[model samples]
Target: MTQVRVESPLATLSPELSAQKLLSRGQAVGGVVVIATVVLLLTLSATVGFGPSVLWYGQFAVAAVTVVYVAVIAFKLAMVFRADGSPVLRFEPDDLHAIPDQDLARYTILVPLYREASVLPYLVERLSALDYPADKVQILLLIEEDDTETRAALASMELATQFEVVLIPDSPPKTKPKACNVGLSRATGEFCVIYDAEDRPDADQLRKAVLAFRLLPDRVVCVQAELHYWNPWTNWLTRCFAAEYATNFSLSLRGLDRHRLAIPLGGTSNHFRTDALRELGGWDQYNVTEDADLGIRIARRGWDVRMMVSVTEEEANSRLGNWVRQRSRWIKGYIQTWLVHSRHPVRVWRELGTKRAVAMHLTLGFSTFTTLINPIFWALFVSYLITGPKYLEPLFPPLSLYAGLATMVLGNVMMCYCLMNGCMERGLHRAVRAMLTVPLYWGLMSVAAYKAVFQLLRPSKRHFWELTEHGLVSHEA
Candidate 1:
């Protein structure tokens, strides 16, 4: 008897096709649920002497807002997809070959560490292996003065002569941005980039960013590199997290650049002009998400931020607790930034001009607020399903319900489309399995958003750096 080999479920499905299928299925399922919920609510409302007018009017308002928001985003994405030439400063490795090598700009890389000893070895090795001239690159391992264990690990490594340790003076509110500000004060490079201790960036990322700077207009002050993950297959949490990163870095950011709006800077691999950064007072020590706050400041000051195609592969938060902590910090920072900027919206809009100011506020300002609102909306939906029209009676009418359902469906389709575009761009189409985790991811984000809001209100509460522990290491023992 002849035996046939069996293919695994994943092996049998074409990654590209699977990604498309997953996106389409999600949109369909979500649309159906939203529509059914609206219809059920409307029917119950009618029986309780509530007309459909309220639902229709409320949905009309929501639909109008959603249409405009999505249209702006879609147009921006199209522009990014159609753009020519590199978005970053590009210096060919061959061009460096002719520069007599001695006149090359000295580059400094700052990796701010706080209780990250486990991943320090890998980070150090990766930085040392970069394609740039080792002699010209100064790798500063910035550590908190009190993080003795991480300092000890760095001392143990027989590192190359190019690497040096910079100990930040101990201070209250020990956050990464504050540590980075201290490092910035000591940096002597013509240009600099920030990396996290857990990052495994591409060796040529620096070279590409330098080239981009040369090609961009004088107004361009910073180059943001695309961040991705190498081990998305390890678990569901990681896979979903990686997908979110890919979508934001690859599509959302590029789209932002297309519209000439402020692109919030990522936490790592962001190349900046030393003089310009210095003029801006470096990173904000008071803000939790200093990078994002800085981006808005740059844009308001008439400087441009561009995105480079170069990809940096880093680890995602594998543990749920770790993910929540990291996310909470980010959301908290967003709330802080939004409040700070909106404090003088009229002045800000006048400085940034109308379009960019509005864009910045909506993208960063409303993001956390929207996520926090999701839980309340979802709760109302479930209540309507269980007790009929009692919960939704105060919100809207029947016709408005249908309109709201349509808007929700359309918005979800757009979101999925944007995500699919990123996956297709990166050739990680198989990673779409992570799409199945969207509901859970949204729920977690809702929880984090609410927590962030609470923390933001209590300004006196000192928040600590919730470190994400890395589980995978490729460095040799």
Candidate 2:
């Protein structure tokens, strides 16, 4: 019901675009109650026989958690192979040019910023250089009203007529989605797309997107392009990042699109039909990772999101601290989105059906829960090494013990293999050696995941966006 119904011609004219609560009253209260119950149980266990309590808890939590994660990883393994075999559309620049000027749709590009003044020059340069028809494209530089520094920097530049600074009124939540909502309200285009300040997308990305929308059925409403870390050779962190992106954008996402599963749209380079976006109430202002939320929402509204082959080059967070902050925010938002949608589990399952509902959990739910509980599993591993499998014995009987052992060993190996295959497919040679040491990176992610869980539990900081600093590395795209 959120998206514009295909049968409803006046859907675009009637706007239900408004910023709403981050979570429903029922959902928020239910979450708080669940957390309180867990705390109380833990406290009670401290007074009770700790061994008995720990045995049952560890048995269910550790074994079940790892097994579920392995299943999800198995799905990803299939996606890696499926993506390799799938074909993508390729068009020469002349093909786009051949389409008459008036036939092309007017495109609106929205880039929301807080304190990104440093990258404004390069951003303008990259955006202005897009090969899309100049007259048909409008770029909205959505800036926060209170961010005087960025606004001043933007003012200093002599931007083209297409580039306009759309100042968003100061508001709570103050997330990128909030700024994006303001820009969306004033957007005048047949289609709209989002870009990060440091992104340098393929010049023909827009044309490719338009072609996708044209060729696909009415139900296909959004298209996400391939995202790549342009400066992957910058550092160890960036190299690992490149491998992750390769797996996610090139392999996993394409597989999702091919199978008609919910595609978690990347933050940038997600092209949407303007009408469909508005019908979904634009972006959830409170969701820090609104792109992912919107992708799921699009599927719920009886629409599908497709993937494009064009690459959108983005800057990698080279600094460990900066990378952790960004990763934590994303994990936090995934937690939020999952809670919001799964509030009515039956309704979600009924709406999306079995396959898609499962896809949602394995994607968003998998990332959030696995990262948060990974350290616990690691601790269990250490405990097993020192003592034995007494804690794990209950979950894995004599017959299943070997299988459980294989899961433990194969889980890490599979992930490393996925990273290597994805990296090699993308021609990122540096990541081959880097994958051998990627477990350390995963430990860092666990660090961020813990931070994300703590932040999510804090009601006051639920919407607090830990912005990642871009422009650290600039290389030839």
Candidate 3:
């Protein structure tokens, strides 16, 4: 069989989807104008002694935006209650037994590794447990050229014939998606999925994904499995992380699917038709969050990504520094994905339609915007409590004050309730208590969001992939 040399097809196939250019000329100009206008307003207000009046209107604008954000969250919570119409697919035991070993589709599993030697053994064990025929399944472990630690670890292991170690060439953008592209070129399977080093997917996940593909319409080319932490009991951080994942994978993603909106896929456990993935250009090598970008591209091409009922348990970042490092990269990737897609608004609007186009903006653009501005709102609330609302009251008139108050009161209440309910639904009762401290988690997110913005601004650091250290927890719960 001849091997295909696949590169970042975004440059050739669709330059609009590529992250090669961080921002288009139009977007940059618009951004500069907006920044200049804000600066001019502040300067004029300070020099002309009209700062109070400018702040008064600014407060009302913020209050209105907050209402929209809270309303979106409320919509997600409502979707959780209406799960019967969710696009998540589930299969019974009988469904699995009905398929014979000879009839199963050829499946490929790609594991991208970088300085993850510690978890290599665990990963191999998990992959070995996948309930698929050995002859039909192909396992490819993608390792970077300079990653001697992982290479040495794999060399020592007594591996099976189905397992092959694929060395990625030294490249400029040394990213996971780049390595996965090399793996995709060599894949012989009909369907493929990407998994991180510390992932432990359910034994029947691949089979379930195959069944989902067969049962769904031909337009559905990918199946995304739910991801949650296996070590939630490890610490306060892990517990909080697990709670967020519970809501994200189980509720929020389902909401997007129900609405036929573009689903921002999780990093691991996304199963794709091998040919469809290749045609879509594998993944954007320049984008840090390649998975999210691919999900949007899938939707833009008129291909659908369905949610599978299977789960993949991963080790959460147990340390604060590690968590922030990982989060900053993800946030940075979201920024990249948004900028890449927003380059041609009219085309995107036409392709995704009004509803999906708006959903994409809210999911990627507005969510990141909120993370960056959350600190301002938090500081204002603190000031209101400290100095009494005397000076602030003028800024927030009766209507704006009530809306802001409701956002402060009702927003937090709804979010916390969603977190707790997500935990209860997922049988993660221990994590329910950690939901109360989610405000603290938001502070951490703000720190990461700022870090992401800083990195995004630096040309040298824009494509840097922050490696999240795994194998921190000794054992899983």
lDDT of each: 0.70, 0.80, 0.85
Candidate number of the best lDDT: 3
Which lDDT tens digits does candidate 3 get at residues 1-477? 111224432333366688877998899999999999877877787779655557755775767777666756665666566555795798887898767889999999998899999989988888988999988888988888889899888888887878888877767798988888888888899999999999989999989988888888889999999998888888999888988898888888887888888999899999999999988888988899999999999988999998889999999889999999999999999999999999889999988999889888878888788788889888988998899988677767777778777877887778898889789868999888888889899899999999999999998999999999998888545
Which digits, one per residue and each the tens of the lDDT, describe model 1 over residues 1-477? 111111111122122211112123444577689999777767767678465654664656555544454544455455446433334334555754544446567788988888888887777778888888888887877778888888777777788877878777676667777777666776788889999887778788777767666667768889998899887766878767777888788777776776777888999999998888877767766667878988888887899999877778888777788888789889877766666566556778987898888777667755565677667667766888899986676564555566555545665565666566666666768877557446678789888787766765564543555666764534331
| TM-score for each predicted model, relative to the true structure | 0.81, 0.89, 0.93
1 versus 3: better lDDT goes to: 3
Cα error, residue 367 of model 1, in Å, equals 1.9
Cα lDDT tens digits, model 2, 329-432, are 99888877787777778888988889999989988888567776778767867888898977556765554556556765887788899999889889997679
Every model's Cα RMSD, please?
14.0, 5.4, 2.8
Q: Residue 76: error of model 3 in Å? A: 3.5
Per-residue lDDT value at 231 in model 3: 88
Candidate 3: regions farther than 4 A off: 1-13, 38-57
Best-to-worst ranking by lDDT: 3, 2, 1
Q: Which model scores highest in TM-score? A: 3
